[model samples]
Target: MEKLRLYIQIHQLKEQGFKIAAIARKLEISRNTVYKFLGMSFEEATDWVVSLGRRRRKLDRYQDHIVYWLR
Candidate 1:
């Protein structure tokens, strides 16, 4: 996954003594994002990235109306 790749790249760059600001510039990502990825473990990053794809339920706004109608 692209997120995993980025995470790995951040780690590699950090290991090579790149500063956080430099990493952000090199990757064209925000410094906050760089810090976030750096602080996270690999599995944590994967879970966080995978969870980004989850969408809100389409009918969530109508749930109260639907329940009333059913009742």
Candidate 2:
């Protein structure tokens, strides 16, 4: 979700005539990240973010145990 928001903001700033370096500074992100996001289309960005959510974390195996403990 956060990445999606950042991607949108990057594009908006770009459209508003902001330079890539300026956008990186304003957003406090690395220039490379800004470039990477700008290179992706909206649909591709959306899919990338969605795929991130679907990735398995190292702690994923303990998820059920963690939830059971919390309860």
Compare the candidates by TM-score and give the number of the best one.
2
Q: What lDDT would candidate 1 get against the real structure?
A: 0.94
Model 2's TM-score against the true structure = 0.81
* lDDT string, candidate 2, 1-71, tens digits: 89999999999999999999999999999999999999999999999999998999999999999999999
The lDDT of each candidate is: 0.94, 0.97
Question: Could you estimate the TM-score for every candidate?
Answer: 0.73, 0.81
How far in Å is the alpha carbon of 24 misplaced in model 2? Answer: 0.4
Q: Mind sharing the TM-score for model 1?
A: 0.73
Instruction: For candidate 1, write residues 1-71 as lDDT tens digits.
Output: 89899999999999999999999999999999999998999989988878877757889899999999999
- In model 2, which regions exceed 4 Å deviation? 63-71
Residue pairs in clash, model 1: none
Candidate 2 residue 52 C-alpha distance from true site, Å: 1.1
